[model samples]
Target: MTPAARLSAAIDLIDIIDAQRIPAAKALKEWGTAHRYAGSGDRAAISGLIWDVLRRQSSAAWLMEDDSARARLLGMLRLERDMDVATIAALCDGGRFAPDTLTDGERAALTSRTLDAAPAHVAGDYPEWLDPYLAKAFGDDRAAEATAMASRAPLDLRVNTLKGKREKILPRLSHLGAVETPWSPLGLRIALGADARNPGVHSEEDFIKGAIEVQDEGSQLAALFSAAKPGEQVIDLCAGAGGKTLALAAMMGGKGRLIATDHDKRQLAPIHERLSRAGVHNCEVRTPRGEADALSDIKASADLVLIDAPCTGTGTWRRNPDAKWRMRPGALEVRLKDQAEVLDRAAPLVKPGGRIAYITCSVLPDENGDQVRAFVARHPEFSVQPPEQTASVLWDKAEDFAKAALQSDEGWLMTPRRTGTDGFFVSVLRKL
Candidate 1:
């Protein structure tokens, strides 16, 4: 399909998304099913355009002076794709299967519009309702921070220490232009362009042999903060597809007992194959049953309890842009409730002097600092560990990392603009 035709399809898809209030993925899927003539390349191109429009929604609308699908897509071509007016006009030329010719208004707007006078929400391309929350987290730099979150994310992978060393695996993936991540020693990164298809790492021998797992550097750092050690019992309270579970397994080096369980069993389906593929044996999987406790047998035995709490995922907007727009005020309330409930569940499982690593992908203070403070308030026996101790695992870079991240009395916050990572807040709480 022509690039122009792809753009037209994307515009139509966005209208369906806005009208039906459905997810972008669902709309894209339905479009694909109906248009079977569109090949994989055409579908990918259309989906990429739709995602970019979602990411650049607010800014594009502000630039074009219109919120219509065509205006947003056209403005995104200028802002995100870096297409000049002439370049954009060439693609939009009125023809069979192409968008209509650019209007004098669109051409003039594209040539003259700039974000200098735009509001924070427009400049940052985030929902307006989140401005206050972002202000609390970033102060005057909220726009810059949110702008970073709106950009494309690099692909990050974790080297499984259980199978191979970083240097060993690094050379094998070099053909894909892999580089070591700045923050995570176990992480390798692959930079992706706007329309680039992902390299088929799953087909690689190293991946098939379970030498690496696709995990974000932020997540790797979050798990590292827990400092899980060999022969130590660790409980990953919300394992979700075992991303952190595998990281914990690598940290334990097959000596400690790692039990991974989540309240939802469907989320655990992918974990067994992942654990088996990674050659992990010391870990156990406990699926929850009908209204029964999965961790009933284990009481006050965990040396460390890791809660990768459920969140609004503001930190992951660069990768999941559609979620940011779909999120509402009530969603934040629901996540807060879920987060508190999970924190309460983790308290009893920790033995005396054991630590609970509280982590969230949200940059919102209500979910990060406020949540941690509230948890400590309810459990007077628990106290937040110092930022220095949490950064100790970072070794010589500890002080620099401490300086780079936002350190509050509750914990440290990492953002794309601050630490070059997804939005993550991690704090360690020790039971007295």
Candidate 2:
């Protein structure tokens, strides 16, 4: 398909998404199923256009002076793809299967419009309602931070030490141009270009042999900060799909008692297969049944209780841009309640002098530092641990890591602008 035709398709998908208020993934899948004649390349190209529009939706609308699907596409072409007015005109030349020629208004806006005068939220392409939160988190640099998060993200993979070492698995993915990640010693990163499909890491020999697992560098570091040691008992209080649970198992070196459980049994389904494939024998999966207590047997006995708490997921905007537009104030309220509940549940599980590693893939202080502060207030027996104290042992150039991450009285905040990672907050609280 011609690039012009792809643009037209993207505009149509965008309209459907706005009208139905559905997610971009659902809209793209529906479009693909209906247009079965479109080849894989054409579908990929169309999908890329749709996502680019979503990521820059706010800024695109601001520049075009219109919020229509077509206007957003034209603005994205200029702002995101770096296409000039002349270049964009050629693509929209009223040719067959192409978008109509841009109106004089659109041409003027494209040539003269700039984000210089726009508000921070609009220029950064984030929801306006989130401005206060972003301001609180980043202050003067909130705009730059949000802009970085609106950009595309790279694929990251963590070598499963339980099965093989990074040196051994690193060479196997060399064909994909994998490079060592900056922060995670066990992670490899593959840069992705605009409209480029991610390489199928699951199809690789290392993945099939259980030597590698797809995980973001920030997530790998969060697990490392838990400091789960060999022969220690650790409880993954919210081990949905076992991403971090697996990481903790590797850190334990197969000598610890690792219990993985979640409130929803369905979320625990995938953990069994993942644990088996990774050859993790010391880990156990616990699925809660109704009001039954899944961890009653080990109360106050765990050396570490890791809560990968649910949040607004604001930090993952680069990968799930549609969610940012769909989020509401009520959703954040619910997450706050859930986070508190999870923290309370984990409190009784950690032994005295043991720790609870509270984590969230969110940049909002309400879900991160604020939540940690509240938790400590409610649980007087627990005290906040400094991020540098734990990060110093796990990462090289400990001082550099501290400087790169935004540290609060409660924990550390890693953002795309600061750590080149998905937004993640890690706060470890030790029992007094």
Best by lDDT: 1
Candidate 1, 233-264: lDDT as tens digits: 99999998999999999999999899999999
Clashing residue pairs in candidate 2 are none
Superposed by TM-score, candidate 2 places the C-alpha of residue 142 at a distance from the truth, in angstroms, of 1.6
Backbone clashes, candidate 1: 0
Tens-digit lDDT track of model 2 for 1-432: 898998889988999999998889998999999999999889888988888898899899999999999999899888888999999999998899999998999999999999999999999888889999999999878989998898889999999998998888788789999999988989999998777877888899888878899999999999998889999999999999999999999999999799999998899989988888888999989999889899889878889999999899999999888889989989999999999999998999889999999999999999999999899999999999977897875556577889899998899899999999999999999998
Misplaced by over 4 Å in model 1 are: none
Q: Give the deviation of candidate 2 from the true structure as CA RMSD.
A: 1.2
Q: Which pairs clash inside model 1?
A: none
Task: Show model 2 residue runs off by greater than 4 Å.
Answer: none
Question: Which lDDT value does model 2 have at 121?
Answer: 97
Q: Model-by-model lDDT, in order?
A: 0.93, 0.92
